[model samples]
Target chain A: MHRTIVDADKQKLNLNLRELFNYRDLFLILAYRDLKVRYAQTFLGFFWAFLQPAATLLIFTVVFGRAIQVDTDGVPYPLFAITGMTAWTYFAFVLNQSGNSVIGAQEMVKKIYFPRLVIPLSKAVVGFVDFAIAFLILGVMMLFYCFSPSGNILYLPLFILLTIISALAVGIWLSALTIRYRDFQHVVPFLVQFGLYATPTAYPAETIINSLPDWAVAIYYLNPMAGVVEGFRWSVLGGAPPSDFAYISFVLIGILFMSGLYYFRKVERVMADIV
Target chain B: MSDIAVRVENLGKCYQIGHAKSGDFRESFDSWINKLRGINNGQTGESKEFWALKDIDFEIKKGEAVGIIGSNGAGKSTLLKILSRITEPTKGRFEINGRVSSLLEVGTGFHPELSGRENIYLNGTILGMKRREIKAKFDEIVAFSGVEKFIDIPVKHYSSGMKVRLAFAVAAHLEPEILIIDEVLAVGDAEFQKKSLGKMEEVTGKGRTVLFVSHNMGAVRDLCSKGVFLSKGTISQQGEMSKVLSDYVNSEAKINKEGGVVVNVSPLDKEGKWLKGTFLKVEVEWARNLFQEGINFDFSMRTVDRVKLFAFSSEKRPDFKDLHKRSKITLLIENIGYVNNELFIDVGFKYVNKDSYEALILNEQLITPSKEKIESFLRRDILVVPGFQYIIE
Candidate 1:
């Protein structure tokens, strides 16, 4: 027999990893469900995943590479833009999906008991699957350009991991906040929209680095995705590593991750009631 | 201690009623930061405290099936939520000495795009069944739901009844040590409901504890050996199943406002105390055959001098559906603002598919409670208005 106690006054803020591990199958099942449902009724099915980044790549290449002629050093503008978009798209998707995850599972939250973190965590995983497909397209593009493999390519995994962490960090806070203040839902799409340009997605980061003063550059990298964008380009296109300013991105991401987790845990207890 | 499967001590759940009239972003954001900083000073907003479950205490020994009986808003569902760990209590605590699984609704976590087979696994996991256990019971669950032919098809195509059957099959197959169910068996047809009840009985026969909440007294009498009756968020009676049930039925009789042939009355709040500003829901039953196209029932309150005060109609309300044969419906009066006067209920029915309902004999007479009786129920010299500063003595 297992003993369970429920006390309303006692809040369980501890991250109970053992309980999470016990429900790991549920996490996998939810992630699988999200993946299957995304393309279930679509006409193009899984191609839609590749089509999103492809469409973005086309528009960016035309606007920035052709019309404006944004410098990508010597690397092809399409290759550089796609590499950055692939990572940025993953972060945006995770933020959008995970942010609405609690509201999406409103019925389940009120009915049963499971680790609530699983809802947002599963969105991150689903977003990663789409990211993986987009990355494969980049690999094909890399080969198409006859781009030689660089040793910096090994750092690619580290940057991907950073992108994943950054996405989950923002995702957790938005998802938790959306439950109490429905105003946050309206805020998400705008964040993702404005965030695309805010991160150095379509244009080169070097343009901002060389043009801005040292302190101003440091302030720009405070956006967690700033480090992610610069690191990803360096890993894929084999440029010099991101400047000292990139280290600010790491500090910003760490603070964001910790605060997001704290805010999520605080609001989690009242979720079933408000949701 | 070892013999007890569940023990709840002074358990309570409080909800802050009424949305704030005017809230600013700065106020909420401040509280949010304070919450994150782990500094809870308990000063947040201006909402009244409504104790949904207050000082609710009970115990169910292992292998015993306990029935929870209550009227609408009697905290039955809130108690189940706390027991299921879906929500936290605002006060007190409870302990359970077994693997507990609750069925508050059918197909809670099911996705419509998933096939019936996949939903079984998905829902089973939500109810806390391991993958291997679901796999072992896969064939039995499919056969029980009677949806073998459409097992691989998306559940969107399945009829609602078929969905209920499939969901109940998975939940019934779950082999938890303690099973908590809330009004889910009310779905599906009579035969399926009977089968589900039998499945519940079988679970208890295997020495598992069961906590059942239902309005159907017949089913509760058949399955549960002990009973708890909740009224206004507190227990009013508990003992042998028959005794507790009798107490509940007898208490309803004490609050019956009238002896009318047209309608039966069941009070909503305890002893018919309708707090100001809160909606009062009265359960009414009448013969369904009297229902016709454009047939309408209206509840009116009038002064003793025959002057009408207010009239509410059932024309737009959804609960007025299925008023054929014998039917029970709830009439919700949104706010109880009347003060310093005793108002009586006058129910009138009209059967009109035409322009005028004036000539129709709505009802032979009005259904009004005794004035003295209402005064005794209120037990106060002055009626205090909600959201106003006053004391009832």
Candidate 2:
């Protein structure tokens, strides 16, 4: 028998990780629903995932690799950009979807009781499906170029873990803030667009790294996706291993993610009342 | 103490009504800037706090079905919500023993793109049922909904009724130790209402505690043995179902005067002391000069199910006279036969001379006390025994 006590106090950062784990089935179903629902009404279907980065690779290969070469060492530009694109796509999808998840589930949020964390976490899971498709494209492209992935490929899963945590860190923070301030909702879409250029998806991080003064490069790593993109490429394309700047990205992601969980739990108490 | 399924102790929920109206950035940012400048933004002055449920204290024993009756804005839903953990209370606390399931609104989490079969699993899991539990009850739910044919079709394609049936079927099969429901019986047709009511009774009969909130007085009386009546965020009465229900119905009958019409109904014993289940004194007042040819007051008694048991027009009295000035008409009926069905008296008026007049009718619901006193034999089909006498003033 479960005895539940509800009070006005203790409305702080109570994560209820056990409760969240108990609702793991809800999380998976929601992720499954998010994935199925996208294909439910669309004609192009999951191909959209593969086509988005594929098209971007084609555009960048022509624009950057040919028209305005930005020195990718020697690796084919398509192979170089695909890794960064896959990482950024995962980061952007999680940020955009999880940021809007609570508002999108407003009806359920107001009426049902579950660990609300599942909503954003499920968005992160759905983003993985897209990431896998984009990563598959990267694998096929590597085969076409006859380039074996760097032995650093052992660190690919670590980078993927960093990608998810970095995405969820921003995703969780933005979603909690978006509940209180709707203007954040408008900004989320713009983040995905602006983030495409701000990260190293279209060009190597070196292009900007080589130009910036020493201190500015340190600040550049603060944008978590930069490290995510560089880290992904180093593990897959075996370019210069990401600079020590990537460590700053790792540390900042740790701070942002811890604070994000704290802030999400704080807002969750008032969520039913406000949303 | 262990038998108490729910106990609310001084529980209250407060909502902030403010100029900002919504949780948007501009106002919060402005307020933040104003605070940085050490100036008050006047937001604090403009915002007011309203307690939806205040100092609400009650207890429901296990196996007791309790009905919470209230008028609109009466905080019934707030109580249920707090108990269900849908919203946190502003002050104090509440305790619920055993597992509790709340049906604040059915079909709350249904996704349009998901097939009915998928939604059944999705919504069930959302409402806190384990997947294996849902899988176990899957066939029973689909059968109960009678939508087995459309189970594989997306919910968006199902008609609204089919969707509700599916949602309600899922809700009905959830066998929690405590069930909290709010106004779900108001949906569906008469037959369906009967079925829903039966399902609720079955829940109570299984020795689970049920806290039910609804405006349907008859259904509440039929299902709950205990009752709580809420008015204006406070509990006005709570006790045996018979006492609480009668008090609720009687208090709802008030002298309403808007749109140039007022109606008041109160009962009296032959000795003239205020009483109930006896003769009724009905007063109908209308604005002067509107009824040029005098007004005809219509008095009616109908079953809560809306079967018009009797309707009598004032113009039928031989001694009645026409008046064009301020008019107050009173009708004293001798007896409203002792029938146990909950009844409603509707008071309406229009000009007696105009065959068809521009609508000037106000239907005030005058209520009859619960038929707790009715003998089984007296409770039959519609019984409209007219008053033994009528006196008009």
Candidate 3:
């Protein structure tokens, strides 16, 4: 006689990665759809990705480099601004788009059942594709300026990963919140626009750090994007790095990532009903 | 042998009902006040909690196709949502031994901007089909959906019927271990409905479990071997489809008054007034056969203000005669009086059908009459008895 054992009491929600892995092709397709639709009919196509950062670089190079006279660690103002804006633009775009993923796909979510995580995750993945296009533009600019990447450029991938993780952390939180409060839909665009100036996206962090109190500086280090921007500059430029601030930023990003995941899972089960 | 494929234990879902009036300023003020109280008010004003599904329990074995029948707001959709894991139950537990796929709404997972071909892969993925599995069945899905020429077009451009057909094709082709469908098959034309039913029958033949919810009794009887009747968020009856359906019909019959038929005249309103004349009267005649006894049905009509509009019986008519087998029964109204105020007219009919011992009654609102147009009331066919045939000279 064969006894089939069933763990009746083992009632817990398990993250079934195997199932997610099986559906990888679907993920790729959806991500590809996002990329294609975004640029399909536009005149600029992928050039829009580069143009945005280039525009920001031009403005920052004038205002911060000339007017404020912020030191860019001996790098050209345009180069400094484009490098930071490239990374920041990708982060901001991913954060903004992924935060609205679940609510934006309300029709799909209610009609079919899939791992809800797939929606936001797919947005993040597609944002990376855009980031890659923009990154190529940044590479061309680096070549034009005769700037060569040093050994520290090897760590650029880690910084890129950090930016994605932080974006996703914030994305998941906002995605879940947006389902219940549709006002978040209106709030996100403004938040992203405001965030660009608040963070060191258009200017170097040193100018702002020098003017702040020590306690305020400590608090400023808590902004995960601060470390991200500083780290990107250090990795790409291979100059002095904000090593201590980077560690704090990494820790803060990790905490944000985990907490965002927890809140997202908590609210995920109710999304269909509330949405 | 415990062969249960599904076990639902004491499942319940609660929803908050808001009573916000349909205007802007009042609703916004109510919402603001509620927010000020820090109540996280689910909605605005005079709110009440409703149990969409309460303490529901049932079990289904493998290969059983159970039909859920209910009127609107009867919690059928809530039950399916819980079963499909689209939403979690507020209480209790349910377990399934096999993979479950739900067609809650056809074309739900489809993105309108994407082509039908791309949507198929996207929908297949959402339904948990592997890429290679979808690839193998790709041609069959397209063929079954019958949108071969339009498959490359963006679904946003597809007709609503075409969208549903494509969606249903993807769902049915996947062949999940358990399928939960919720009235989405009602979309598309009649031919497509028939084809979809045939496809569903083929799916069930493979011994997969199916749960179908629909209001159409004929379709339920034809497709489902078992039926569950839900009333007020509870299962009122469950058994063979015939028995359950009979129970549902019988229960509905009891809720409606037996000797009263209602006629709604709201559809006849014209330009804020009624098209009919002031005085209105209604009569119902029930007959069996030429030799059989004829029954005089009593009816009454009233305005929304509780003013007696008219009350009469078929017996009061001068031409009334005993109805026999194959005899013509006519109900004629005489001397329709006048009206004073714009009012809502309601009519009721009471009689017993020939086949049953219980009296059957129905009531409906006739028309909304304004005070200015009280003088112009109309007399129309409240009920057109379709089963009667006449012999011409």
Best by DockQ: 2
Residue by residue across A1-275, what tens digits does model 1's lDDT show?
A: 58998776776777776887899888888888888888998999988988888998999999999999998888898898888988899999999898789999989999998889888988898887879888998898899999986899999999999999999999998998888777788999999998897789888787888999988888888778988988988998887788778889988888888888878877778889887
Clashes of 2: 0
Model 1, residue A154: what's the lDDT?
Answer: 97
lDDT of 3 at B380: 44
Candidate lDDT scores, in order, read 0.79, 0.81, 0.70
Model 2 spans with C-alpha error above 4 angstroms: A10-12, B19-22, B34-45, B255-261, B270-278, B286-300, B311-338, B347-366, B369-393
lDDT of 3 at B198: 86
Candidate 2 lDDT tens digits, B1-393: 488889888988889887453576677777778889999747643788898989899998989999999888999988887787877898888888998888988887888999999999888888888999999999999998889999998999998888988999899989899898888877766676778888888888899899888877788888899999999999999999988987886686664544466667766755533323466677666666656656566667666666666677767655555644546767665444445455567666657666753333333354554344543323347565645455443
Tens digits of per-residue lDDT for model 2, A12-108: 5577789889999999888988888988878898778778878888998999889999688898889888878889988998998988899999998
DockQ-derived CAPRI band for the predicted complex in model 2 = medium
Give per-model TM-scores.
Answer: 0.79, 0.90, 0.76
State, as a TM-score between 0 and 1, how close model 3 is to the true structure.
0.76
lDDT of 1 by residue, B132-224 (tens): 999999999999999999999999999999999999999989998999999987888878887888887888778789999986666687789
Q: Model 1 residue A248 lDDT? A: 91
**Candidate 2 vs candidate 3: which has greater DockQ?**
2
True contacts kept of 1: 0.74
